[model samples]
Target: MHRNLWSGFCLSSLLAVFSTLSGCIDSRGIIPQALRFDDAKLTTDQTIRKADRTVEWPRDQWWQAYGDPQLNAWVELALAGSPDLAMAAARLRQALALAGVAESEHAPQVKLDASVQRKHWPADRYFYGPGVLGDTTGWNNTTALGMNYDLDLWGRLRSDTERALSLAEVAATEERAAALELQNNVVAAYIQLALHHARLDIAEAELKQREQLLELARERLAIGIGTQLEISEAEAPLPEAHRQIDLIEEEIALTRNQLAALAGKGPGEGARLERPKLSLHGEPALPSNLPLELLGRRPDVVARRWQVAAEARGIEVAKADFYPNVNLVAFLGASSTTGDMLNFLTNGSKLTYGIGPTLSLPVFDGGRRRGKLSEATAAYDLAVEQYNQTLVAALKGVSDQLIRLHSLHEQEIFVGHGLETAERRYQLAEEAYRRGLTDYRSVLEAQSQLFDQQFLEQQIHAAHLTAQADLWVELGGGALTDDSGPAAEQLDAHKTTLHLPGRH
Candidate 1:
């Protein structure tokens, strides 16, 4: 018999069971072997160099390299308390449970049944007990063993088992994704808080310089040398700085509150983060030289690809109809009739098993069954498309991050020079003001320049770090840390997490 002939027969049966998803799939649409984005073509690859040395992150939790104890403690606390992580754990168990279910289906189901009964008869009633009607009525006991099995019958059960296993893998990937996202959010929030604090300090220092200038200007005005407008202008910087500082305080409070919730702690109850520090592993390396092919290794992409295959199997399972199916069912368990277990063991002899063959062949079903098969077919196609799209999106994110990282690192370098210049000017302005050659206005202007430059530095540094974090994610570490379960597995030799579906 032709393989396609049998496949069609099985599919016809599926049409009866599953509802047809009309128009969900393109009937004539050629599902391109879902194209992976050409990453090499997209990226302008270059090595990033730091003044100190060459650095490569090597998939380790590079964030720890910064040596900030406070940052470490906060991450630990948040990991333990995060409800989202807990939820992801629960999902992992669920997937594992489903795998168990599929595995169990491959084994025979065993059952034991027992019962007891008491009956009273009228004084003149005729009653058939086990003693009277050959064990039809009770005080009576009966026992037997039974079992049943569904033969593979065109590999439907096997496909089902594979589908379940794939689903479990997808769940594991989702867990990893969740962990990565949770940690990223925590780090980002901490950076934001640190940035705000640094800004506030800058503002305050600027304010103090302005206050000194205001006092000097007012004194000069009293002696008719400084204008009233000059004193008023000198006073303005202090309030502005104070207001900026107050705003930063509000942001810090908000960030702390968010961290508290994420860490599963009350506000101000856990490890406090000091000023943020940047620990970047030199420049990030693109995953493998072949960027497009490497995307298959990404957990998110692989997980969804598994779904596509599983859906294909589901369609096959539904199609199990076109061929004749033979089932082998038998029972080999002790069954007892009578409330007393003792009587059944003593009175009934133990018996072993029986087997029977049940066959099913599709005759006709008004195209209903065929419709279901088509529906599954369409679903598989849809799944494949979605998987491809996710891969593209993942590649795009990586490319975008690399571009940003390159530019931001350069921007920071330039900004560093600007800051140095501002510092030098501030130093010169102080001497001039003391010598009474320059007005207090020059002192205030120099202070403002220094403060602004410093503010830009903090922001640029944080932006650069964040860009790296995102790049790591896009490259498929997706938050794989040295100690993490899947992350550890992916890097080290134990259970391999490398299931790239489309990659050669």
Candidate 2:
């Protein structure tokens, strides 16, 4: 009896000491409560205006830069039709909802539960006094309410909440990236269709000119002045131009179908785009050595950066599992093991309650927790590497686009001059042949040359339009304006996303 008493006393003292030490650990979790991305400072670029080219972007409507109302309408329809945009919007909401869940965890957990039970005993059972009564068949009734909570002795909860918020920000950034990409696709399709129509028109015009030359050659052959070879040569270019038209038509149809899918309607939904009278202007000058400070403006980069932060917080969560966890459980109830339920509730109803913290120490787990922490840490490192890779890729795209724009513009200029000279040469050749200064063969050669020139011009024109679109995509498209978001916050302290850190 003495040994048992001493052991119990020693245990009580040990508990008292441990309780004082446990005060250092708290269910309040991390200090200051919230981990905010506001602390992440972004570097600014002072050289944004040094780009040497100062041209205004088509602000109200990017498609207007092409000076085509039809293109504007088609692009708008595609933006409205994109199912991917809708999906992206929905996902953003989902992530925000998950963030709300994490935020809720920061508050005290509260719960309520109610239940009832009935029990029966055999008449043979007897206890206490009144042997005859105890031997009677009987039933028992009980009702109860319960509540339970876990005390956050480690920073696990706080880390989890921060991770959730980061994920939400990542979702929002992804949505923006998806929207931008969709817009670029719509515009690209519209421009391509317009370019094909332009080329087809030029091809048909050349084909008509060839038909006129062929008629003249046949007349000469009938008069015995021209050979069958001359007539055949003049007719050759006609089929080539028609063949070009067929290829262009095929491309136009396919592009229209692509636009249709983008608009979220039947494959033929978007407004038909007319080929704009595009003034073959020299290449659009892109901004050079853009401020690295605005690198976060790219949604893809920002999203990736947030992912890195989420992984970092995950590491902390794994580390937390290495510590002890404290849970508090409690209940209140009334019960009576009596034959009469009403009588049992009359002053004899049992009432009870329980409140205490449970400490779950990390003793032996076969290294599972350690493995998880290592995995989380590795994932964080990978995310960082990916962020750097994205940054480099974005810069490379901009650089390459700039070079192509210049080269394409120069090529178009020379091709335009060549087409004009060839047209004049064909007109002179026809006049000379009619007056007998040249033979049917000279007119035939000139006509073919003109046909070649027109076809070359068509290709060069398309190349110009393609290069322009490339520039838009590189500058991240849309009206060139304030490229940075002051209102958009970094979502994670260790990473950055576009919602002002704590606003979402």
Candidate 3:
């Protein structure tokens, strides 16, 4: 009874020493220095505030709003085949697999181990005991089944798993962002093709007009009422008009090739593309939820937010390292160098089995744990700042698109009026020249003015279309919804708020 009491006291004293040693490695001075930015708390810029906010959030297939079936088909094709998206999908899968690895830490691990080898015992008089078969060779064999499980007393495994899952979420959102960007590229390139077609029409018409004026000048000269200079003036513009047609056709071909490449097809496929029929009926208005919903709407922003959450979990994982780890371990095995190899398995005396709990306390690591915690905290701060920057840039992108669209709309109206006036002025000038009331110079001036106005109109129209597509991209292209949360719930569940070293 006295010996039993002594053994128990010694065990208690040993545990006390372990606990005191563990307390020496402090984690009090390390903490994350960055705070996450709240989307709702961020003030909306005047640019977003002043814009018309009547439209709903964009639909998932926002490109279809342009009423172009071909565009929709191309976007779908790109989503299916683009290398960029495929890579993003692969990265997401990899992250999910890593998350699985982390989660497996919570479950018991079982392993089977077996070994067999031929051995020889040398007869050394000083090292060998008196026994039979002292110099004999024999088969040595062993087999064991072992299991281990971590207790996770400090939530380390949970935080690690959560961090991995958050990174997986980040990959998913980045994949979505890549898809949206692909869609935008397809639409923008298609719009350029349409603009080239419009320009071609203008060029062909101008060519025809120049030919007609050249013929009319000849007739006037034949009747002794027009000078040779008039004929030369009309002929001069014909080659330029033809050149313009050639340039626009080249642009159309190049844009078609670009669209085909975006869809992961060859230049020959682009050669078969028809002229794009893209139209936007009205201005794309801002959603009622502006900067607030913008957080979830933009895939890039969502990805950054997920990254921040993952980093927050990383800090937790690092903090957990400062504590002790406990693991339950069990093993059952047999080993023998005598009799048959199977004797160890069958003989009860050769069998061995044991189960116990193992403890690991970090008594000293020369500030390694503190350094890791510091690194994790710094990474967390970087992620938060990146998220903040993404949010700001996203809002700025929306405002910039809105401003361009508004300006393009106003420019389109003025260009349209100018085109009409130039048309009337050219018609009057032509009539005056035919009636011998003015020289060819006045008619040439009016025609040049009309061509300039027409070109400006087409340019403004293309700008308006491109701006609309950009706005759709900025608004998240229907990836966002009203119910999208800030992804704080999961992080909050495992959050261990700690004070910074210098702060309260």
**Candidate 1, run of 10 with poorest lDDT:** 495-504
Tens digits of lDDT, candidate 2, 1-504: 999999999979967766566455332322222232321232222322322253433233454566556666766775676799889989989998988897787665656543334544445533435454445555466655665576666788889989999999899888877877876777667656756676666667667767877887888888878789878778777777788889988888788778888777775453354444443222233333343533445677788889988988988888788776877866776766664646445677777777776676665566677677777877787777777777766666656665665566577678768877887898899899876688777777887787677657656656666666665555556534645322232221111111110110
RMSD of each: 10.8, 9.9, 10.3
lDDT of 3 by residue, 1-504 (tens): 999999999989988998898898877877777777777777776667655443444666888877778888888988888888899899999999999999998999999998877778777676765565479787677899999999999999999999999999999999899998999998888888887887777777778777988999999999999999999988888777888899988999999889889988899988888877776644444544556766555889989989999999999999999888999999999888876656556663268899999989998899999899989999999999999889888888888887887687678768768877998999999999999999888988988888777777777877777888898899888775534422221211111111111110
Residue 492 of model 3, lDDT score: 14
> What is candidate 3's TM-score against the reference?
0.91
Which order, best to worst by lDDT?
3, 1, 2
Query: Each model's TM-score, in the order given?
Result: 0.74, 0.76, 0.91
lDDT of 1 at 177: 76
Evaluate all candidate structures by whole-model CA lDDT and list the values in order. Answer: 0.65, 0.64, 0.80
Kindly report which residue stretches of model 3 are placed more than 4 angstroms away from their true locations once superposed.
1-8, 282-284, 287-290, 340-349, 481-504
Q: After superposing candidate 2, which stretches have Cα over 4 Å from the reference?
A: 1-61, 116-118, 122-144, 150-153, 222-224, 227-229, 232-243, 271-291, 336-349, 437-445, 479-504
What 10-residue stretch in candidate 2 is worst by lDDT?
A: 495-504
lDDT head-to-head 1 vs 3, winner: 3
RMSD of 1: 10.8
